[model samples]
Target: MSLLTALGVEKRPSCNVSTTAVLVESQGCRSKDLVNITACSGACSTYTLYSAKMKALEHSCSCCQEVVTSERQIQLTCKDNTEITYTYIHIDTCGCLEVDCSPFAHSETTNTPSRMRSRRRRR
Candidate 1:
């Protein structure tokens, strides 16, 4: 057992859910009357150490992710006094999941980003 663990040191969870108010703005419209957003926002364990089994360095990591999510729609008031509907993923539950730390496995997105899809409708 590790010294810290054997000494009775408390260990926090690697990842968990957190709630915060995030102002969402898009296409000159903003959401100021929205409720707080809940999402996975915790630090994950990452370390590198020497491994005797392989006689080399070893790396381990975990990342906070949304284990459960649901689609949610919100109305944003625009500057023109008009409103638009935006749909987004609401994180219902979150946890730490093992992930590949290789940059090749993870794609870096640039320029063309479509995070939130909004649609205007006629009433």
Candidate 2:
């Protein structure tokens, strides 16, 4: 019954979190410990398509973003041997969500060459 999934035709990239090592520094001070940073990444669906019913272009956009974040503080060793606190956002969760693609929104479009010409003329 499932043609897409059972046939392995569904091959969309999933949004998820990725990890990397980063050096944290502040005010000439750097963290003495190795810091691991996690970030939201990957491709979410984004498209611009022509709609026959509306006689216009439609754009749908979603992005991988942090759904939940936590504030974290770290101590950095300064040149004077004093410890300084630095705050950063730690990504707790990530998901795909709709983002603002255009000022015209979903119902309206701004991609056609004719429309672009009209806009330039008005300006």
Candidate 3:
């Protein structure tokens, strides 16, 4: 199943030329899972799908100068026992496309913790 369908998102009529923006969250280096999809036409309407885990999120869409601006925020938990929260903004202009993907670590930072103190002191 398409990630959107897995997320329980209602599919909308495809634009003649449509750009898709997806944000995913997963555990550790594993394939990221699609958590949301936001599609828009340059006109004045946008479509959004929310997963069962994200029922209380908020989204907004606005159109200006043949550009569709869609902003969405969602919080998701992955099967790997990790939680990720993300916000994405998609701008579709003149049938052009732009996509941005960012992944974050869910664990506490140990990059410079005291466990390395002895090594640093010896240096």
lDDT of 3 at 29: 25
Please give, for residues 1-123, the per-residue lDDT of candidate 3 as tens digits: 986567554444233324554546434322255544444444433335454686733343433232456676666666766666666664444332333222223446645454456534553
> Model 3: which ten-residue window has the lowest total lDDT?
96-105
Tens-place lDDT digits, model 2, residues 1-100: 5433454432475888888898898899999987888899988777666678889877767889999999999999999999989999989889888887
TM agreement with the true structure for every prediction: 0.60, 0.68, 0.26
State which candidate has the highest lDDT: 2
Every candidate's lDDT: 0.74, 0.79, 0.46
Error of 1 at 29 (Å): 2.9
Error of 2 at 2 (Å): 12
Which whole-number lDDT from 0 to 100 does residue 82 have in model 3? 69
Tens-digit lDDT track of model 1 for 1-123? 884456453355557778888887889999868556887987766655667899976666678899999988888889999999988888998877767663332455533347456789989
TM for candidate 1 is 0.60
Candidate 1 error regions (>4 Å): 2-12, 102-123
Task: Give the Cα error of residue 13 in candidate 3, in Å.
Answer: 19
Clash number for every model?
A: 0, 0, 0
